[model samples]
Target: MARLREEAERVQAALGAAEVQLERLGQARETVTEVLAEPDAATTGQARPR
Candidate 1:
Protein backbone atom coordinates (compact mmCIF):
# COMPACT_ATOMS: atom_id res chain seq x y z
CA MET A 1 0.00 0.00 0.00
CA ALA A 2 2.82 2.39 0.81
CA ARG A 3 4.49 1.71 -2.51
CA LEU A 4 1.25 2.38 -4.37
CA ARG A 5 0.81 5.66 -2.55
CA GLU A 6 4.35 6.68 -3.41
CA GLU A 7 3.73 5.90 -7.06
CA ALA A 8 0.57 7.94 -7.05
CA GLU A 9 2.41 10.88 -5.53
CA ARG A 10 5.10 10.68 -8.19
CA VAL A 11 2.50 10.63 -10.94
CA GLN A 12 0.78 13.66 -9.45
CA ALA A 13 4.08 15.52 -9.30
CA ALA A 14 4.79 14.72 -12.92
CA LEU A 15 1.36 15.94 -13.98
CA GLY A 16 1.81 19.17 -12.07
CA ALA A 17 5.15 19.82 -13.71
CA ALA A 18 3.65 19.13 -17.13
CA GLU A 19 0.81 21.58 -16.47
CA VAL A 20 3.29 24.29 -15.45
CA GLN A 21 5.35 23.71 -18.54
CA LEU A 22 2.23 23.96 -20.70
CA GLU A 23 1.26 27.23 -19.08
CA ARG A 24 4.73 28.67 -19.68
CA LEU A 25 4.60 27.61 -23.34
CA GLY A 26 1.19 29.22 -23.70
CA GLN A 27 2.47 32.47 -22.28
CA ALA A 28 5.45 32.35 -24.61
CA ARG A 29 3.13 31.91 -27.60
CA GLU A 30 1.03 34.87 -26.55
CA THR A 31 4.15 37.00 -26.21
CA VAL A 32 5.30 36.02 -29.69
CA THR A 33 1.87 36.73 -31.09
CA GLU A 34 1.85 40.18 -29.56
CA VAL A 35 5.30 40.96 -30.90
CA LEU A 36 4.31 39.82 -34.39
CA ALA A 37 1.20 41.97 -34.39
CA GLU A 38 3.06 45.18 -33.58
CA PRO A 39 4.54 47.60 -36.11
CA ASP A 40 8.28 47.59 -36.84
CA ALA A 41 8.60 51.03 -35.35
CA ALA A 42 7.22 49.74 -32.09
CA THR A 43 9.72 46.88 -31.81
CA THR A 44 12.99 46.49 -29.89
CA GLY A 45 15.02 46.70 -33.11
CA GLN A 46 13.55 50.03 -34.20
CA ALA A 47 16.41 52.14 -32.91
CA ARG A 48 19.27 50.11 -34.40
CA PRO A 49 22.00 51.97 -36.27
CA ARG A 50 21.73 49.64 -39.24
Candidate 2:
Protein backbone atom coordinates (compact mmCIF):
# COMPACT_ATOMS: atom_id res chain seq x y z
CA MET A 1 0.00 0.00 0.00
CA ALA A 2 2.77 2.41 0.88
CA ARG A 3 4.61 1.63 -2.34
CA LEU A 4 1.49 2.19 -4.37
CA ARG A 5 0.97 5.55 -2.72
CA GLU A 6 4.57 6.56 -3.43
CA GLU A 7 4.27 5.58 -7.07
CA ALA A 8 1.08 7.57 -7.42
CA GLU A 9 2.73 10.65 -5.96
CA ARG A 10 5.66 10.32 -8.35
CA VAL A 11 3.36 9.98 -11.31
CA GLN A 12 1.43 13.05 -10.23
CA ALA A 13 4.61 15.07 -9.89
CA ALA A 14 5.78 14.05 -13.35
CA LEU A 15 2.40 14.94 -14.81
CA GLY A 16 2.59 18.39 -13.23
CA ALA A 17 6.03 18.96 -14.70
CA ALA A 18 4.83 17.88 -18.14
CA GLU A 19 1.93 20.32 -17.93
CA VAL A 20 4.26 23.17 -17.06
CA GLN A 21 6.51 22.29 -19.96
CA LEU A 22 3.55 22.21 -22.31
CA GLU A 23 2.48 25.66 -21.20
CA ARG A 24 5.95 27.02 -21.78
CA LEU A 25 6.00 25.50 -25.26
CA GLY A 26 2.68 27.16 -26.04
CA GLN A 27 4.02 30.51 -24.93
CA ALA A 28 7.13 30.00 -27.02
CA ARG A 29 4.99 29.30 -30.09
CA GLU A 30 3.10 32.55 -29.55
CA THR A 31 6.34 34.44 -29.22
CA VAL A 32 7.74 32.95 -32.40
CA THR A 33 4.56 33.85 -34.25
CA GLU A 34 4.85 37.45 -33.10
CA VAL A 35 8.50 37.62 -34.02
CA LEU A 36 7.86 36.16 -37.44
CA ALA A 37 5.04 38.59 -38.14
CA GLU A 38 7.61 41.25 -38.99
CA PRO A 39 8.96 39.17 -41.93
CA ASP A 40 12.42 40.57 -41.27
CA ALA A 41 13.95 38.31 -38.65
CA ALA A 42 11.91 35.22 -39.36
CA THR A 43 14.15 32.27 -38.53
CA THR A 44 14.88 29.56 -36.01
CA GLY A 45 17.55 27.00 -35.20
CA GLN A 46 19.96 26.09 -32.44
CA ALA A 47 23.29 27.19 -30.96
CA ARG A 48 25.68 25.25 -28.82
CA PRO A 49 27.39 26.55 -25.68
CA ARG A 50 30.14 29.02 -26.37
Candidate 3:
Protein backbone atom coordinates (compact mmCIF):
# COMPACT_ATOMS: atom_id res chain seq x y z
CA MET A 1 0.00 0.00 0.00
CA ALA A 2 2.76 2.42 0.91
CA ARG A 3 4.59 1.63 -2.31
CA LEU A 4 1.49 2.25 -4.34
CA ARG A 5 0.92 5.53 -2.55
CA GLU A 6 4.48 6.63 -3.32
CA GLU A 7 4.07 5.81 -6.99
CA ALA A 8 0.80 7.70 -7.11
CA GLU A 9 2.42 10.71 -5.51
CA ARG A 10 5.25 10.67 -8.03
CA VAL A 11 2.87 10.38 -10.92
CA GLN A 12 0.80 13.25 -9.54
CA ALA A 13 3.89 15.41 -9.25
CA ALA A 14 4.92 14.67 -12.80
CA LEU A 15 1.38 15.42 -14.01
CA GLY A 16 1.44 18.77 -12.26
CA ALA A 17 4.74 19.64 -13.88
CA ALA A 18 3.41 18.65 -17.29
CA GLU A 19 0.32 20.80 -16.76
CA VAL A 20 2.47 23.81 -15.97
CA GLN A 21 4.60 23.19 -19.06
CA LEU A 22 1.49 22.86 -21.20
CA GLU A 23 0.16 26.12 -19.88
CA ARG A 24 3.41 27.85 -20.72
CA LEU A 25 3.38 26.42 -24.22
CA GLY A 26 -0.17 27.63 -24.70
CA GLN A 27 0.77 31.12 -23.65
CA ALA A 28 3.75 31.08 -26.00
CA ARG A 29 1.54 30.01 -28.87
CA GLU A 30 -0.87 32.83 -28.15
CA THR A 31 1.97 35.31 -28.14
CA VAL A 32 3.30 34.02 -31.42
CA THR A 33 -0.12 34.11 -33.01
CA GLU A 34 -0.66 37.65 -31.88
CA VAL A 35 2.71 38.68 -33.22
CA LEU A 36 2.02 37.07 -36.56
CA ALA A 37 -1.33 38.79 -36.77
CA GLU A 38 0.38 42.15 -36.68
CA PRO A 39 0.77 44.00 -40.00
CA ASP A 40 3.77 42.88 -42.11
CA ALA A 41 5.27 40.88 -39.27
CA ALA A 42 5.95 37.98 -41.57
CA THR A 43 7.77 40.11 -44.09
CA THR A 44 9.71 42.26 -41.64
CA GLY A 45 10.17 39.66 -38.93
CA GLN A 46 9.42 42.21 -36.25
CA ALA A 47 7.00 42.10 -33.40
CA ARG A 48 5.48 45.15 -31.82
CA PRO A 49 6.81 46.18 -28.45
CA ARG A 50 4.70 45.28 -25.49
Top-scoring candidate (TM-score)? 1
Candidate 3 TM-score versus the reference: 0.79
Q: Candidate 1 vs candidate 2: which has greater TM-score?
A: 1
Q: Which prediction has more favorable TM-score, 1 or 3?
A: 1
**Candidate 2 lDDT score at position 11:** 100
Residue-level lDDT tens digits of model 2 in 1-50: 99999999999999999999999999999988976675443243444234
TM-score of each: 0.80, 0.75, 0.79
- Candidate 2 matches the true fold with a TM-score of 0.75
lDDT of 3 by residue, 1-50 (tens): 99999999999999999999999999999999986777885577886575
* Alpha-carbon RMSD, each predicted model: 4.3, 7.0, 3.3
As for candidate 1, its clashing pairs are none
RMSD of 2: 7.0
Candidate closer to the true structure by lDDT (higher is better), 2 or 3: 3
Which of the predicted structures, 1 or 2, would earn the higher lDDT when compared with the native? 1
Per-residue lDDT of model 1, residues 1-50, tens digit only: 99999999999999999999999999999989986787776455575244
- What are the runs in model 3 whose C-alpha is more than 4 Å off? 41-47
lDDT of model number 2: 0.82
